[model samples]
Target: MKESSLFRYAVVGLLFTMLAFSCDSEGVINPTPTPTPTPANERFLVVGDSGTILVSDDSGATFQAVTSGTTATLRGAAADADGHCVAVGAGGTVLYSADSGDTWHAGSCATTNTIDRVICYGSGKFVAVGEATGPDPYGIFRSTDGGQNWDRYAVTVTLRGIGARSDSQFVAVGNVSSLNDSALYLTYTTGASWTLYSAPSANFPAGAGWLYDAVGTSGGYFVAVGSDGSLYSADGGTWSAGGAVIGKLTAASWCASSSRLVAVGYGSGGGVSKGRIYYASSLGTTWTEVNPGTIKFLFDVADDGNGGLVAVGAAGEVLYSPPPADVHDAGSLWYDGVSGVANELYGVCHVP
Candidate 1:
């Protein structure tokens, strides 16, 4: 080959060699660290008569469309340890999510019954309770496999809520069709057998007319909530009136770890024209009011323990209450000294 051509070839070869060595030595320039995806944060969901759902990530600070699934009014939802969740509502509807809540496995209630609320009993079991007019006395259903299938456990009266201290022990709240009396209901055998309570009194305004949700405390102390400001006890079977929960008191949820308690519904009765909820860190003192909207009627509330809370309501409003700047819910250690404003968040639960 010519001298100049040969020189050019040598230069090209040298350049190629230099390039190869450079790539390996200094760690391949800006090689991305396999971008560790920002794990999905806990989310809050809202469901109401609109048959649509709203979701938030920043402790109800803001939200966007988490789902447009199911055109039925979603009334209730329950979350499991495996991040699986289910929501039910009008026209006999149910929607399940295995990925925190990004997507869903929608299903028909099969009874056209309105599932008012649902709860997870650990493991893969779930219980949903509500009222129906069709065949038999419709009340509650047991889904052992995270709502894949449902078996009617107890059907009578209007069972609004179901909670379990354990898989075998639980309480379902609602009133029976007898006289002019309303009561709180309990079941020790996972809804197989049930007993009723007086709920402190039978008078309206102060008495629990129709119970909604039940929450179990650390020391066996349980609180059940209902419309028209209702809070009752399930000591053994008979519900005793705990007291008139502040606000409308539509739903009651407890965070045992932080000792946080939340109840949402509406503003004061009588003179109260709209709906609001009462929140407390101790549940033993004064309850604070959260401003969601002018006609905000909170239907449910839940804690995700990610220093946050989610509440849902009648209006299309959803709010979040982060772990108080003090992480205080209802205790001293947890007392972060910050007041958790009960914004109208729909539902909130821990992801991990």
Candidate 2:
């Protein structure tokens, strides 16, 4: 072949090789839309260590945290019948809000037990429970004046959380007491009395898991969650395993009817992605995940009363709000989509 022809072919081959390399070389594509997003017209509060709690009243659409001055790690929160909100956490942490998280004040943890969870029913009445530290440990405390003053009741074992089907009928759960040291604590007197109860363990491929959270619904149903996909059950008397049905039920709530249950937990083992909502009509059935998922860590979820669900969690996460037409039925913000947290969100509530 002629020298000129050979040079032309060489140039063409080099150009082709360069183009192929450019196409194959690892380079970032536009980042996939973060599954965690703020929904329009929804509200959210991001919880973190001593950081201002971020609040978004317009659904997960926008957010603002109180910056006056505070730096306590809030772990749990709940709303009252009038929509007032209360939060609790570290440093004997207890917080209250009259303007729906617009302003906050540290209440009191009653004991320095690392109060991890709290719930409010109404009439300035609230019950908060957490891990016990020293002697006379493991209990649920009551607050009558909107968390202003607390009365702590001592129990033998540690309780992770407390819930009530009514003011008189209450339930709390932790490790079930066994010769092996596993125990679960339950009460009927709104913590006026606590009894050691046994429930089915969240049986893992390896071993039984630890109980993390629990909620009691109207009628005669109660559900519990634990590590590595463990679930437990209590139907007034019997304590049985709810099974390893859901992936990670970090936070859950009873809604719709006594039969409808919604749970938000995550699967993204790395960080805060792959969050999902698992729904169950009944507690005994295995839970199934909701589709069209995003990288969201649905931590704590609640029924907003108008047919929609509100769940909050890590990474400033809130479930993006539903459509505008559904607003009335949806009721309030943070009703069903995952969101992003500047820090971490452990608790949220609507103080109405």
Candidate 3:
């Protein structure tokens, strides 16, 4: 109980308390903070006939089949900002997936005809285009509630392709009637109305020109591909000839991150159905063909958003081409016809 001893004891106790507080109070050790993990890059969904779907996590390097609850042949597909996707196919069949591309459920727009194309335009907006088997239904439909309900447009033509610039503006490409001529449809009022756009003579050759697919670029430019060649619309109307691609181009998509546009389809060369991809640095400009070295028929091409591209085509072939414009060096085959399970892939879209 001496004064000096009491002072020493009090100082020791204070030092022990300070040490305890510095190392997390209540004897709880603080863990080293871990930085948040970077998410997986480049998700994609490739859809094809017989309601088949293949999903990829690393761009398009690999794929696995996901269950789609229908036997209807799917043609076109698109994904939203939140990883939701909608795919359309024959007999007005629509499939929607909430968890990226894992599982899909059926959705409809009340038509027995085929739904050729579907696009997700962010903010819970979706658009689908196809022909009507009968006269009672329109060719285009729109959904605002994440594809839960659809509102049909008034136009009466078979729509093959569709794209949206924003939540309200959209462009569709297809046949005006059962005729073999090309047609372009535009809507600024979402889906309330549409107008068929006529093109001036860029003088397409005297063949039955048909537009198969259309896409809206970043700067208000729209590019469409078809059996004859490629077409361009600077202001979403008043189309002019972009140029004639060598083969039948079915689908086109623009990559704003790399300033490239890729169009895909099949062509008969060397007496075989070969896949063709045309690449351009800018829209409405001349494009160069880059052979991915595949004889499979390619129907759709999409940008992977990481300076690369993924294309899907006949017999469920999913092709991945990396940057620096070397697509032939990177060929990862997703499907082959050896198993008797090959489905013709008609559409592909990047999952954000």
Candidate 3's C-alpha lDDT? 0.71
Q: After superposing candidate 3 on the true structure, give the runs of residues whose Cα lies further than 4 Å from its correct spot.
A: 1-40, 198-208, 269-273, 324-341
Which lDDT value does model 1 have at 201?
49
In the order shown, the candidates' Cα RMSDs to the true structure are 18.7, 10.8, 17.7
Measured on C-alpha atoms, candidate 1 has an lDDT of: 0.58
Best-matching candidate per TM-score: 3
Give the TM-score of each candidate: 0.72, 0.73, 0.79
Best of the two (1, 3) by TM-score: 3
CA-lDDT, candidates in order:
0.58, 0.58, 0.71
Q: Write the per-residue lDDT of candidate 2 for residues 1-352, one digit (tens) a residue.
A: 9999999999999986665432111121122233434344544454555644767665544556575145777788776765466677775677777666778776665576667778776667888877665664746777877776778877666666666666666666565434222345566665566666543433212343555677775456667665555444444445555645435667667664335566667665333346666656546356645531346566776554434455666666655434324433232223343334456777655434
| Residue 200 alpha-carbon offset, candidate 3, angstroms | 8.3
Off by over 4 Å in 2: 1-46, 67-69, 135-138, 176-182, 198-208, 228-236, 257-259, 268-273, 321-341
